[model samples]
Target chain A: EAGVVQSPRYKIIEKKQPVAFWCNPISGHNTLYWYLQNLGQGPELLIRYENEEAVDDSQLPKDRFSAERLKGVDSTLKIQPAELGDSAVYLCASSFSGGDGYTFGSGTRLTVV
Target chain B: GESVGLHLPTLSVQEGDNSIINCAYSNSASDYFIWYKQESGKGPQFIIDIRSNMDKRQGQRVTVLLNKTVKHLSLQIAATQPGDSAVYFCAERKGGSYIPTFGRGTSLIVHP
Candidate 1:
């Protein structure tokens, strides 16, 4: 079975530029999540999606960060006018409903200069 | 504002020895716990998991012990190898919730 897939494994952009990351979860998984990880720290939840509906997104920055899960299979996380602090690894994970563990992607490492 | 935290930021062990990593969680309502191993430039990979109802769960050479009395969780890696060198994180999830909160990771360095 294939693991979670993410594109543009490394991204470098200037501050104030827009950047987007994409994720394709494992087949048949019903739950998807987006997380941000800073250097030397664990991942922090940004948003979670149960199918097409976002059940929890309180941690997402509404001013510039936005996410969408279309058809509940693929997801996209965007940060508009990115800041230097936004430089971190963006990780995506998916799991089966009521499953024991989650499958994670390799993640996109974003570098904002 | 419950949180999960690790006791050690880094641990160095000789290869073939056993290693223990510890975590403490503030949320008593969290019923599900997971241990994830993350390598450089990669996302966290699930190593083992234990529920509140379980005190211990074992998989491969990894074991997870949950002590609800003190809200402590631990991961034990036996016969550690160089491949086991990575950052280990403990995550907790409340009952009836799928979202998990991750703690700062413990970096394990297995010296050969």
Candidate 2:
């Protein structure tokens, strides 16, 4: 089976500009997650979705970051007026359910200057 | 706040030798733990997992040991090869939650 897919393997944007990353989770997977990873650091959960509903987003910076999972299949994470600190890899992962291990995508490398 | 951390930032081993990576987690309530290998420019790939009830779980070439009493976790690789070189991360999931908390990874370098 094909693994989780993410678009635009790399992206460079100016600070204060808007940026978006897309993700397509595995087929039949019901849980999707967006994580931010800095150099030499572990991935930090930004948002988690169970189908179309986002169940966990407490860590997301609501003022600048927003995410959506439409139709419970694909997801997009948007950062408006991106900051220089936003430069990091945006990873997407999916699991069959809350009990299964996650399958991660290659991730989108975002660089904000 | 709950957190997971590794004892070493990097580990170096000669080929054909055994490699061990250690992690310490603060959450005693965590019931599930996973080990992941991440090569440069790639996302993390699952290596193995062990439940809180189990003291050890073995995979093809990897072994995951869980010490619930000390809140410790370790991953051991037998006959390590250069292909095994990568950053390894340990993640813990709370007993009732699906969300996992990840620790800073340990970079493993296998010398051939």
lDDT by residue for model 1 over A1-113, one digit each (tens)? 77899988999999999999999999999889999999878899899898999988999998999999979999999999899999999999999877544888999999999
Candidate 1 versus the native: TM-score? 0.96
Steric clash pairs (candidate 2): none
What TM-score would every model get versus the actual structure? Answer: 0.96, 0.97
lDDT of 2: 0.94
DockQ of each: 0.78, 0.83
| DockQ leader | 2
Candidate 2 structure quality by residue, lDDT tens digits, A21-108: 9999999999999999998889999999999999889999999999999899999999999999999999999997764757999999
- Which docking band does candidate 2 fall into? high
The local distance difference test score of each candidate is 0.93, 0.94
Alpha-carbon runs more than 4 Å astray in model 1: A99-101
Residues B34-89, candidate 1, lDDT per residue (tens digit)? Answer: 99999987889988889999999999999999999999999999999999999999
Cα lDDT tens digits, model 2, B12-90, are 9999999999999999889999999999989999889888989999999899998888899999999999999999999
